[model samples]
Target: MKQTTMNRTQRTVCTVLAAAALAAGLSACAPLIVGGAVVGGVMAVDRRTAGTQIEDEGIELRAANRIRETFGDRVHVNVTSYNRQALLTGEVPNAQERQAVEQLVSQVENVRSVVNDLTITTFSSTLSQRSNDTFITGKVRASLVDAQDISANSFKVVTERNVVYLMGRVSQREANRATEIARGVSGVSKVVRVFEIVSEEELRRIAPQPAPVTTDDTKPSGG
Candidate 1:
């Protein structure tokens, strides 16, 4: 009963956080979803190693800082890193700024590669558009959570200009399944996959192991 109660609390907390993020319209994109066993379940089911996760976070921060330092408010870019692969989205004034932004992100420490999807547009996305994108991101995340067959936590979702960008280490089967699900969401104009494809065997190899249960009979004797 206690375990069940804890699970319910965790879910409620995650739901509230997700709602808050949506309301704020933060650029971090997808609202965190509670999935699988418990809260923090998203990170638990993530394919990246703990070290890789830290590195990815650092890559994003450093890249964003570099872009801001270099271009100031002239260019609008969103850097999302998964498995050390950095994805650049949003708008730039021209082709030259787009290439420059990509170069800056690529120079960030530990970035394995970069996918530049920045549109060459003079005008950046407006507040209303960004709000809609945030809404779309939340809807897509919720749909992924609803799908029992595929692990929603495996994918990192980002939306810009109504295009949904998916990043993760997933098998072809999982990638296709996620794409279909993302496309079915109402506000998604397009879905761009940035997945690092792995074999099912590889996925199994990296899957999180279950914690060992301790019984009273197996308790170690005190010294």
Candidate 2:
């Protein structure tokens, strides 16, 4: 999938929702029908890591007052992560508000990097941030699909703002390799490692069944 100027992530999600409504109008097998997608074809998940959860809590804690004051108790920003990278996604009213969110988040400890995916709700760049985020996730999935050493199916990509969080059961080396690809993508601001290192024994248990095909996919396309 290609990234559009309007936040493709949000658009894609909305597209799925719209397609779902349309599919319901046309189909009798509602349960078997997936909106805008097929389950067996390819799956992209927002697989969050333990570190990402911690980072999210920390960010929320840090910005609780500002966000509440800005939105008047309606928490609009969506926070998610994988491998310690924190992603902030949602609409903010203005550029000042967006910057405020980023400034506050940068103060959090243990954060390797921040990808500011917050879009100003102005007409011009309203969807730019969102499309960038979706592109980041797609690129990461694509990398995993193309990498020979990585198990693309085991990892998940989560975006908060423009940051990419990777969650997977990978060895340290594999995780490092995945992070490298994520960091190398265009438009990626920073890559945060939020993975739980898997030992050889765990790998054997987690990947007992073999896959018929292979993909060189890695972590998030852009962080």
Candidate 3:
């Protein structure tokens, strides 16, 4: 009984750790729990192709680094990339700074387009406000996951202040459903759809198919 209890405790600890890791966006560990695919599992479910997903991540990181080097705390910005299109949110001290930031982001490699949503404001958001925004993003994501008709993995949720920005490659139905779900979430002031709209036929063509399960029937009979 003691051994069984110890095993149960160890399993619970590992489960908690895995959940924390996933919440922190360390999705490479997904294969351990969801079968063997590494990051490929996530890519498979995402609306974007694996190459596009990788490129988007690279685009966001490079753009962010450039913004930091160029502005150096003169502006507050959050960069989100989906399907190689960049969305710039948060605040800037002035209009000139906002324009400059948009141009700077546009120059980042492989960024197909830029959506400048930077507010020209005198003050940046406080840490508490930013924390609240993060909480709102998580809540929106959870709500989407709970939604029956939507494939939550298809949408990327980013929150700034009280606004929720959604990015995805989805059909009109999927996009509308996702937007409605996001808007209905508590504390979400607005929903901005930055989706790469695809037709249902195109979405079906690009969607990843489930891997086939195989069974080994050649095992020798045991005595």
Candidate 4:
């Protein structure tokens, strides 16, 4: 009977020891999993922030201007961010309405800036330029995408009167490269850079691409 009791105690102790070892192993792995989750969350937030930073501010200013032009000083206009860039679409009632919207947006903080592209046409049509505006936007966006030197996701582009407005957080080098690319596009007559550099990634992405080389066979001999 004593021998039986000893074996039972030994089994219980071994079970407890095994459980403790398993717990320790899990404890060690928990941090790595947790660390990965934290890093992923941060990256997602940054991308969201970058995406909305210019666009929200842009949409807000555009909405405010539309309201002010449509409702006059009756409505209060406020702008809350910069990652957003605004393109004034549709028709304004008069010249006063156009200027009023511009002035209001100018005063709004975090407004990368405003483009008063509103046409002073008759409201008879109520034509939505959203699609047209989107087409121009896609053009500039594709141009930016083709050139790998800039973080295409980091920019908010708006086009007005063939002028391209670039808004985002980027290094000076990135901003310059962006300007150059926009200027080179066929429809772009001018480019406005409204940018702020926030990190080193901006600097790294803006380095120019190496030029292509040609062999002697491909090039004519110099006279």
- How many steric overlaps are in each model, in order? 0, 29, 0, 8
RMSD in Å for candidate 3, one decimal?
5.6
Q: What overall lDDT goes with each candidate model?
A: 0.84, 0.58, 0.81, 0.55
Give the lDDT of residue 137 in candidate 1: 87
TM-score of each: 0.81, 0.46, 0.83, 0.47
- TM for candidate 1 is 0.81
lDDT of 1 at 78: 94
Q: Model 4, which residues run further than 4 Å from truth? A: 1-69, 72-95, 103-132, 197-223
Candidate 4 lDDT over 1-223, as tens digits, reads 9999999788766444433332232254332211112321221112334345446646675666656666664332333344444445445567886687667666654555665556675442212444444456566666665565665645667655455677666767778888887788775667867566656774445433334776678677788
Clashing pairs in 4: 53-83, 53-84, 54-83, 54-84, 54-85, 55-83, 55-84, 58-85
Error of 4 at 17 (Å): 56
Error of 2 at 85 (Å): 12
lDDT measured at residue 3 in model 1 versus the true structure, 0 to 100: 100
**Could you tell me which 10 consecutive residues in candidate 3 have the lowest summed lDDT?**
32-41
* Top-down lDDT ranking: 1, 3, 2, 4
What TM value does model 3 have?
Answer: 0.83
Backbone-clash count (model 2): 29
Cα error, residue 221 of model 2, in Å, equals: 52
Q: Candidate 3: misplaced stretches above 4 Å?
A: 1-23, 27-44, 221-223
Per-residue CA lDDT of model 1 for 121-195, tens digit only, reads 899999999989988888888777667688876888899989999988999999999999999999899999999
lDDT of 1 at 75: 93
